[model samples]
Target: MVRKFYPEEFKADAVELYSSTPGATIKKIAADLGVHEGTLSAWLRAAGVTTVPTAAGRADGGGAGVPETPAEELERLRVENKRLRADKSLLETEREILRKAAKYFAGETTW
Candidate 1:
């Protein structure tokens, strides 16, 4: 099998992303970048950086450090809640549209 080569710029950006976000893991970043975990590790080492243990995201409920301040945490939660509400609304709208479409196609609608 032929090996795929990623751009050096992409590898650099991936390393920068890993370095900038402590809550992000190599595996996660690699998956996001469509590269292998070992490939990311190699790039990191090439840059003289040692990969640390994986850090959990907020989804995991904790990570590799102290908790955020109460206000920060609250703001984060508020943002997340707003996003979830929007998602719920979108899903409801889609469901309603699908139901109407199904009824119309089945000759149950006046139109």
Candidate 2:
């Protein structure tokens, strides 16, 4: 395997991008920049950038150092709520299809 070298400016920019983008994961940002996640993490560490830890004891990219205003928080919640509802709807449909399949297969069985 060949090792690749990135310029100092590019590394700085990548770190900045990670810090500036809200809700952006290191994995996602690294993929976008065509670099390995570990490379990006190293850049972050070299730049002395620390991620904020969430209540779940995991580092989160959201709310880097600034707290969201009430309106921003509300908007974020609304978007999350919408996504969750869509997920729930899809799961319900899948469950119904599975239930129908099970019923059909059960009826077809004979001993």
For lDDT, the strongest prediction is 2
- TM-score: which candidate is best? 2
Cα lDDT of all candidates, in order? 0.72, 0.76
Q: Each model's TM-score? A: 0.48, 0.50
TM-score of candidate 2 relative to the true fold: 0.50
RMSD of each: 6.9, 8.1
Candidate 1 has a TM-score of 0.48
In terms of lDDT, the poorest run of 10 residues in model 1 is 53-62
Compared with the true structure, what per-residue lDDT tens digits does model 2 show for residues 7-111?
999999999998886555776788899998789988998999985433233343433445666776676667557757878999999999999999999999997
Question: Clash pairs of candidate 2?
Answer: none
Measured on C-alpha atoms, candidate 2 has an lDDT of 0.76
Error of 1 at 19 (Å): 0.4
